[model samples]
Target: MSAFMTKTLKALGLAAVAATLAVSAPAMASGGAAHPHAPKEGFSFEGPFGTFDQGQLQRGYKVFREVCSNCHSATLLSFRNLGQKGGPFYDEKYKNPNDNPYVKQIASEFEVPDIDTDTGDAITRPASTSDHFPKKFANEYAARASNGGALPPDLSVITKARHGGARYIYSLLTGFKNPPKGLHVAEGQHYNPYMAGALATQWSGDPHHVPVGGVLAMAPPLKDDLVTYDDGTKATTHQMAADVAAFLEWAGDPHATLRKKTGVAVLIYLLLFAGLTYAAYRKVWHGKH
Candidate 1:
C-alpha cells in the first residue's frame, strides 16, 4: 500500500474504535448532577469573558511557529503582519534563533509570481499568488493521501469555524491524556471526544497536542523550551496552548481588537447624545412646569 493509504487505513480503524467508545460512554447515568464534559451553555465566542487574551496570543504565536507549522500552513498570514500589537508575527529581532532557519526556509520555498518591471515577464519564487498560498503538500491529492481519506484542513480559519472555537482548541491541546484504563484508542484513530469526526492517527488533525510542544503522530515539531520569551513568560504547555489559541483567534478575526474598540466608541457616542438630549428637554420643561 502507498504510505498515504497505509496511514489512512490506520486512521480509519482508530476512528471506528473511538466512535464506539464515545457512543458507549454510559450517557451520564443521572439527572442528579451534570457531567463535567457536558456541553456548555451560551458558549458564544464574544463578550468580556471570552475576550482575546493578548499575553496568550503572543505565546500562541510562539507555539504555532515552534510546533504547529510543520504540516499545517498559515499561508493566510504574512511575516510582516506580526507587527500588530498582539500578533504572533513578531519582528526578526524578537524571534528565537532556533525557529528562524525553518521558518525562513519554508517562507522562501513559496513561489511568488511577479512581473519584471523592465522586461515585464512573469516570474515565480517562494511567495504566494493572489489566489493561492504556497503548497504545503506537493498537491491537494498528496495532502488528502497523507491523512485518512481527509485532507488536513487549512488552519487559517479553524479557530473561528469550530463550535467552541477558543475553548475547544484549548481543551484539545491539553486533552490528550491516557484514555481511561480499559479504553485503548483503536490502532488507527486518536482518542478525542471534541474532534467529532477525527481520524485515529489524526489527533486534532495537527500535532500540537503532545506533552511537549507537538504530538507523536506527526512528531513534536515544537518541543517545550524551543522558545524563550523576553517578557519572562515561562514556556509551559498550558501557556503555549492559550497563546496559540489567541493568535489563531486573531488570525480568524484580524480586526477583532479594532471591532471591539469601535463598539465601545459607538456606545459612548450614543450615551453622550442621549444625555445632552435629556438635559435640553429638562431645561425647556423647567419654565413650562
Candidate 2:
C-alpha cells in the first residue's frame, strides 16, 4: 500500500479504539457492567412497508391507562391526539379529533385542576380534548416522595429517548430475575438485566465476573391476566409489555406511517420522472445519434 493509505488506516484504527474507550468509560467507572443489548422485537411498524396494528395500539393504550399512567406522566399527550389519523382511537367520521366522541369521553374521565372564574378559588373540572395529560403528582418532589425517592421519568417520548426504543422497554419490563447467589440486593431495589447501574459493590461474585445487569427501584409492573382487554385478547405479562411499548412508540412518532408513505410516494414519482425523461430525450433526438 502507498504511504498515505497506510497512515490513513492507522489513524482510523486509533480513532476506533478511542471511541470504544469513550463508550465503555461509564460502565468501567461504575461496575464494569455494560448495559445488555435488548433482543429485537417483531413490531408491526418494523419496515418500509410495515404499518402499525390499530388493535394493538388500542390495547396498549388500555394498558397505559390502567397501569403506567398512575406513575409515569405522559404530559405531552392530549386526548385529541388519540383520535388523530393513525392513532388508536381514530374514526373516519371525526377529522377533527377534538370533535371525536370517543376522545371526549376519555378526556372526561380525568379531573384537571382549574380555578373558579368568579371567586378565583382552586377547583378541578373534567378534562377536555384541549388539555394535556395531567401530571401524576402535584410536583416533582411529590412524585419522588411517593416512589421511594426515585423520580419516575416522563414517558411522553420515552421510546425515542431510550436506546433501542420500544425493544428496550419490552426487554426491561420482562427481564427481571432473581439475583444471582452472590449478589446483594437492597431494600426497594430489584435486579433487571436490562436496567443500567453499578453492581460491583452489591456483587460478591468473582471480581472479573460481575453481574451483567443492574438494579432498579421500580419492580416489574405486569402480570398474567392483570388487565382485561375490551376485545377479549388474553392479557399475558409478555402481551401487556409488548402492547404498552408499541403504544408508547406510536405516541412518540404518531406521524411515522405518514412519513413512510410519503417516502414511498417520492420514490415512485422519481422512478416515473426518470423513465419519462429518458423517453422524451429519445423522441427529441430520434436520428441525431
Candidate 3:
C-alpha cells in the first residue's frame, strides 16, 4: 500500500513480463518465415524414455556411407565408433573395437592417405580402426568447387545444429519436388520445400514479388532402394531418410543415452531427499507451530 512498495511491485511485474517475452521470442521466430516447411516426425529418440533403434542406426549408417558420404563428411565419426557401445555394432563379442573382426574389416575397406616415415612422401594405406572417416574432398574449397559453389556441410553434428533436429532433416530429405506453376527454378538449383534455402518467388521481375530465400545446392540425395539393408528392411526413400536422420541424431550426441540415464538418477535422488527433508521438518516442528 506504500508508494515505495507499489513501485517495487510494478518493477517486479515488468521484469516478469520482460523475461516471459525473452523466452517466447525464440519460439515465435523459429516458427516464422525462414522455416515454412519444418514438419515434426516421430523419432525413436524423441522423449526422455526414448532410445535409439540399433537396427535403424545401422541402416542409416549404410545410407550415409553409400549416399550422403559422397557429399557430406562425418569427420568426427571413426570406424571403431560404429562398433562401440550404444552404436550399431555394440553387441560384437570383443569389448575393444580394435579387436572386433567386423570393425577391422570395415576399417580396412577404406584407403587412407598417410605420410611415409621412411621417404617423407605421401602414401595411401588401408585405414585403421584409429582413423576417422575419410573425407571425399581434400578441403572446404574442393567441396565448394565440386558442388556448384555451395560447400557441403559436415554431418558431424548437423542434427543438433539445425532447427527441428531430426524431423527437419527427414522432411528436407523427402521434400524435393517439381517447382509449382509460375515458379522459375534457376539452373543448377533444386526445388525442395523443406530446405531452409528454398525460394518461394519466381525469377521474373516484379516489384511486388520479393525474394523468399535461395535454393539448396544439394539435390535430392535419397532414392528408393538406394542402399541394401542387411536386416531385410525395405529400402524405400522414406525409410532411408528416417534411418539416416536417426543415425545423424546419434552421431550428434553419442552419449545421449548415458546423459538421460544420469538425469533420471539425479531426479530420483532429489525426490527422495526432498521427501526425507520434509519428514524431518514435520517431526521437528510437531505441535510447535
Candidate 4:
C-alpha cells in the first residue's frame, strides 16, 4: 500500500478506538451520580393529630428482635423500655416497665457481657430489664473486618441520622434490585438506588444514561418470610422492611409520641386561656366604651 493510504487506515483505526472508549469508559458522576429520590411512605404517626399504631409498633419490635439484632445494635434501648407507657409491649397492668413480666422474659433471653464480681474477670450473664441491648460486634473495627470493611450502623438512632428518617430506611431495605447492564459491582458490594451515593465510577455504559444508585456493602437484608410476625401479619419483604423501619424510628425517638401529645395539650390550653381572656376583656369594657 502507498504510504498515504497506510497513514489513512491507521488514522481510521485510532478513531475507532477513541469511539469505543467514549462509549464504554467508566463514566464518572454523569447520569450514574444522580440518586433516585425515594417516594415518601405514609405512617400512622405523621400529622399533628396522628398517633402510633400500637399493633404496628409491636410487630416492628418483633421483627427487630428476631432479625436486626443479629448484626445491628440498639444501645440506646433497655429491655424495660418495651413495657413502658406507649412502648411496643406496654400494658396497662404493668405501670412500671421494670416490673413487667414480658420485659423481664425478653431481657433474660440475652446474655450481656459483665464482670464476675468474685474473680473480677469479664464474663457473660443473663441481661436484666435495665440492661441496654447487647452489641452485635465488640467494636467498630471488628464490625468492619467481619463485614468486608463496612460497619453496620447502629439502628438505635438511624432514623434520625438519615434524611428521610423511617421512610428512608424502608426505601433502602426494599430498594435492592438487579443492577442495570454495564454496571460493575465489586465483590461484597450490592446496588441499592435508595442509598445516597455516586456510582458513576462503577458504570461502564452510556455516560448520559448511567444507572442511578450507589454500591452498598450490605447485601439485601430483608426477604419474604424473613421474620414470622406474632400478630400473623404476612411476613412479606415489604412488610418486614416497613416494620423494622418503624421500630427503628421509635427507638430513635422513643419520646416522640409523648412530645406530640404534649404539644396538643399545650395548644388546647392556650386556646382556652385566650378565650377566657377575651371574655374578661369584654366584661371590663361592657358599657364603658
**Preferred candidate (TM-score higher): 1 or 3:** 3
lDDT by residue (175-272, candidate 2, tens digit) is 89999999999899899877767788988889888887788889889999989999999999888998998899898888888977886676566556
Which of the predicted structures, 1 or 3, would earn the higher lDDT when compared with the native?
A: 3
Cα displacement (Å) at residue 188, model 4: 1.1
TM-score per prediction, in order, is: 0.58, 0.82, 0.81, 0.81
Q: Please give the lDDT score at residue 212 for candidate 4.
A: 67
Tens digits of per-residue lDDT, candidate 1, 1-289, equal 3365456556655654564454223233122111223123322224532345555566677677667765677667664344444444434564442244434544565565568888989876564212234446767788867765455667788865665566656556655544433333554444444444423243333344321211223322334566786578887665666567667768877766666666556555655665565576667766673
Candidate 4, residues 1-289: lDDT per residue as tens digits? Answer: 3365456556655654564454223223222333322235567665555566778888888888888777788998888888888788899998989989988999999989999999999999999999999998989999988888998888889877876677777778888988888999888889877777777788888888767668888888888988878788899988888777777878887877787678667656655665565577667767774
- Model 2, runs deviating above 4 Å: 1-41, 274-289
Candidate numbers, best lDDT first, in rank order: 2, 4, 3, 1
Evaluate all candidate structures by whole-model CA lDDT and list the values in order.
0.53, 0.81, 0.74, 0.77
Model 2 Cα displacement at 205 (Å)?
A: 1.8
TM-score of 1: 0.58
Candidate 3 lDDT score at position 16: 47
lDDT comparing candidate 2 with the true structure: 0.81
Candidate 4 — which residues are off by over 4 angstroms? Answer: 1-41, 206-210, 281-289
